[model samples]
Target: MTGTMQLAAEGASDHRGLIIGLFGAFVVATLAITVWAGRQNKDADDYYAGGRSFTGFQNGLAISGDYMSAASFLGIAGAIALYGYDGFLYSIGFLVAWLVALLLVAEPLRNSGRFTMADVLAYRMRQRPVRTAAGTSTIVVSIFYLLAQMVGAGTLVALLLGIDGEAGRRWVVVGVGIVMVLYVTVGGMKGTTWVQMIKAVLLIAGTLLITVLVLNKFGWNISALLGAAAESSGKGTAYLEPGLKYGISDLSKLDFISLAVALVLGTAGLPHILVRFYTVPTAKAARKSVNWAIGIIGAFYLMTIALGFGAAALVGPDRIIASNAAGNTAAPLLAEAVGGGPGSTGGAILLAVISAVAFATILAVVAGLTLASSASFAHDLWANVIRKGKASEKEEVLTAKIAAIAIGAVSIVLGIFADKLNTAALVALAFAVAASANLPTILYSLFWKRFTTSGALWSIYGGLASSVLLVVFSPVLSGSETALFPDSDFAFFPLSNPGLVSIPLGFLLGWLGTVVSKEKADPAKFAEMEVRSLTGAGAH
Candidate 1:
């Protein structure tokens, strides 16, 4: 037993060297891509919307890269390994949400907007107030999304280096934040989009490699895989069923419902995701991109089922839990196991390759989130509100770069504080906030002729305020062992997610604010917006 333990330690040391080397290589390659793309930017369009140059397939792939975040990879895999069927449901919600983006938001938003979502929201409303609200909500939602990627980075680096406790994770998070700010400030949108397209391809290829290995190990028999996973999960048949994670009690069930709502409705409102639509040249390209994104993203999520169960079957649930306590390392551990376990060269190579892909994914995502938020601040708030549309393109781009630095610093701080939470759950809270604050205002602005400037302001501010406030008092923040503040008990809200209540309230506030206000929206402007949205008559 002593000899075997010594051998395992030696193997882990070997794997660590290989993993770090691969990580460095991937980062260098992506930075090269960023620098190469950055040299082409000549104006605000190039920096903010990739100069509307990407094809449907390219933009589609980038969207897939941005959407298949660390939450989709690390968080979802960990959830499934621990909770079985319930965990896989997160994939279903995410995939369904894309349809909402495709059918309702894609063409219209592309036709109506420019660099950011505010361009559309402010089309007919009071520009300064609506832009302020949209800018604020965009930054807030992007920050929430940024936290997930940063936390995932910390967890990934910690697991590979065998670093324990908060200090290791904190340093990793800060490093990730710095790297992301560099990606945004140097590359801008064109550079970032190219990196995302490359990252998406790498992620899908890595996932396919692991999925195939897992299937082959099970003799290509899914039933065999399921049986082994169920047995190894230490829950027998319950591991393959629904109640293991979420359906146990009324509160858990309600939490599940809220989670589903957020995941399903949140994609359309995501600032980074929404901004991707503006990167294409035509509304047709936007629609085509959504189709491509759906196909690519759908296939990736299906592969995650294999990843999640493979981890359970090969790595064992207790070992996965022991690794990070959040299951963020399950996919990487499973890669090691499938390639012949810890002591072998095959295991080291696979682990290094998989982990490298994960690092690249996190980097690319953080770049996208930062770019979106900074664009909102510079284009919507700084240029339009602060400078009253008089800021030069050079000045606007400079402000965006500075905003990226500030946002990166803020995300690094929050990432340290929220490092204990699961990446997928952290993203779910972000989704809830986006759904509550951004979606109702977007939908109303596009569809309702009576939507006044006050209605938009009320909806955006009210929804944003309510969801964020609920999260602070909810179990996600305190009162439970898994909460961010585990030592305290200030949780007053019962549900872990606030989507179920906050989303409806957002829509309600928009309606009520419209009805009570005496100010009339510009009918001529609404007619023009409708024509432009539906028929692409005057799209930029």
Candidate 2:
């Protein structure tokens, strides 16, 4: 911490012009795309599935963008900067999760689904109850993840825009909520996909530029950079080891394993990411999209390692901690340090550009989340359940738009209150819920012939309930100094992430329910679902 570089707390005049110009340009371009895409939606399919017109490459970029939220870009980098090798472990888990998505979920999902994950789950079962369960799981996961993004948005604006008061940060959250609502309600999936594509490319380019600048400062020697990082980190060589973040004790190791499991299995279950498969035309395209997304995501995370270490070596942990207690500001502060220090013209411009890109990152992710929740509301709950499959395409689409506004408003309020939580940890809880609630049900539905409707209900409800209940009682809510309630300790669950227990419980309940219930499986329906899932018989 001795070599820590002081951050310049400059007024708005220093970088406001550049930040506004870049952010405004992105907003205008995305809104224009939304308007154009809105005109192309002639039915519910067009609105939810983007007309199934996107190529593998376009969907690939969008998928990468969707996965790499501010959590991946800023949170992981900051974690690595602060915790060293432990932070890099998250990068490994994130990239490896795509293998689960690509190999296990992508092709089957594309062949089976139309608009939502519920489509796949309810393909063989009695539709109403199954769809209701699916819709509930989808909304729960979406809201948890959405709140994390909203909180990250407010925290990022407060730090980057120099917003000092709580009111200022609250306004930032509201503004982001409005922008995301517009993206989903007007643009639908097509516009959101395009915006994600653009944001991914810019994020990759920005990361590369900062990485090269960091390397140049280190005389293009990686070993020297690592050496410097070790020296700056107070722990010396321990900074290069894995025990810094999660290796404190046996329980922490279990916690680390829980995190990895959630990160890996959760990607396939996430509603927003699962829905993206429907945007492609064929099963083959879906597979290819996943392959492309893995490549892009892999490359970006590799750079995050460099960015994190470079920040530790150059900007030092002390300044990063000072900027934000969670170290979420490390990447932006690194940009300021490498571009020529705070007051220099290069520093101001680069910082502003990166800040704007961060805003775009948040916008694209929240738009995807909002779109997924709205689709669940309209397609599953309203069209299929409430209206008994009699709702028209026009009515369903209108319902989705309205749902987007409601979901966005709720997220803004939660974000304003939850801004103090760590963005990365919040996202990890979201992944845990997705893995526990959605993954087990989908797998059994597609693979097992005896999976009855009762089994589906048990799996979804059991998983969702267990995840939510465990998290509420876990250390994140009220325990220790690091807990949300610093002065209290009511957490009974030792692990913060509930994936290790809940995922197994989800599968076990599905199996137990299937065996105990006398509701015989419909052989004809199972045959139909298997044929369609394997051969894309009825897939559009």
Candidate 3:
């Protein structure tokens, strides 16, 4: 064979071996854990909340694991590489969201519900409409989030394996779908918890190792590193500050606020994050877990600043930029270059481990999201609506497993269609929707006695509709042009984020609906709702 053909064959062989090995190891490990956990799962509670047996520390780690997804791993690093200090904005926004969760949402949510966030909302309201609305929101948000993650996984796998994009994407979606199904179906909460905990530690350690080495190479001087990054970056010191450049008109201020709002409130409203509160043994444990999660997450974000700048200075933008024209590849490329050349011993090993961890991150997060969506559909919608009362343990668990498979299938389909979008952007949309549709209703339901079922339904529908519509019309959705009227010269919204608009709408709609339906609400239910939300009275 000619030299060119021989080189191509060797490259293809290496790519194929890497993909198969990493993917195979992930599947085997996930399945083993699932089967072991499945044997221990005897009831719905075990399937849903791991029998609420987790200690504060374990649950905290799992929370951090779930929260720090592929978006955090790849997206933040890429953002820093491209945008400098603008990227750290995401870290700050994400970390601040934990404060909202800890001070406002955590303990009350744990005290109120058993499985889904809807359970808490429906406690004092009419069960059918409340459960229906909350379940719809949960499914919508979770699927959107899952689609983003699956897309990221597919793209990463394709890049690493040197395979056709479509085939690689399908493999990622299928791999994650099957693993998540097994995780929720067999191991239930127990298996999911351990998986997330282990993955979190590995992810942190892996990133930290890279950060340490990168710093060591720079002689432990942060200022020197930043100066190098600033000099090398095309944007200069402006990248170190927010809004010095890249402003579309004077709207940079609005865009900054919009992004901040989405990240801050979004975490508290996320179905997967809220459901974690149920995993802790008590309300107090849930609160403590939030505190621990915040600290861990904070440290991780801080490391990303170093890693992103390191990649910016060390790898340089031109070499890492792909034909696709996104910054997400910077982290992986940097790891390969710094650890060693792609085929070098150090580089190859580090890249393999990072790839494995990235794959694991996708699996664990999708599993949690799928589980949350399943529980919301099965328990909140099916059991509450179809059965008209509490479901037997067997029935609830069975329905949940079935729901898991169904949702996973939907995610795969969406991932296939969303190949062109950035996973981080899609995840941000999920956060915006969650913040808009679910957060306000939850907060009011727990703290405001005036809240009624009518109010919740209206708020949920309004927020969901407005947020989705705004996103579809935002610049991110338009692609090459603005969205508002498609043909119109003016874009409807200045910022791509909709949380700033939709979140307030949710609260206003809820308040207005409550006032109009005042006479229909039962005042007696107020006392009960307060007790359940604050002290776990009647939770079982």
For every candidate structure, what is the RMSD over all alpha carbons to the true structure, in angstroms?
A: 2.0, 2.0, 3.4
Report the lDDT tens digits of candidate 2 across residue range 1-540.
112222444722476777778889989998998888888888888899999999999999999999999888788888899999998888998899999888888999999989999998888888999999999899889989998888778877676667777898899999999999999999899889989999999999999999899999999999998889888888799999989979999999999999999999999899999999999999999999999999999999999988899989987888887776677778888887788877777876777777778888999999999999999989999999999999999999999999999999999988887765767788888999999989999999999999999999999999999988999889888886556776778789999899999988988989988999999998898899899988999886
Q: List the residue pairs that clash in candidate 2.
A: none
| Number of the top-ranking candidate, with lDDT as the measure | 1
Query: Candidate 1 on 1-540: residue-level lDDT in tens?
Result: 123223333456776767778888878888888888889999999999999999999999999999999999899999999889999999999999998899999999999998899999999899999999999999999999999999899888776666667887799999899888988999999999988999999999999999999999999999999999999999999999998878899889989999999999999999999999999999999999999999999999999999999999998888787776777878888887898888788877787788789999999999999999999999999999999999999999999999999999999999998877899998999999999999999999999999999999999999999999999999988999889999999999999999999999999999988999999989999999999999999798
Q: Write candidate 3's Cα lDDT for 27-67 as tens digits.
A: 68877977887788777878889889998989999999899
The regions of model 1 sitting more than 4 angstroms off are: 1-10
TM-score of 1: 0.98
Error in Å for residue 171 of model 3: 2.9
> Sort by TM-score, best first: what order?
1, 2, 3
lDDT of 1 at 108: 92
**Cα lDDT, model 3, residue 496:** 73
TM-score of each: 0.98, 0.97, 0.93
**How badly does each model clash, as a count of residue pairs?**
0, 0, 1
Model 3: residues with Cα > 4 Å off, grouped in runs: 1-20, 244-248, 481-492
After the best TM-score superposition of candidate 2, give how far the Cα of residue 376 lies from its true spot, in angstroms. 0.5
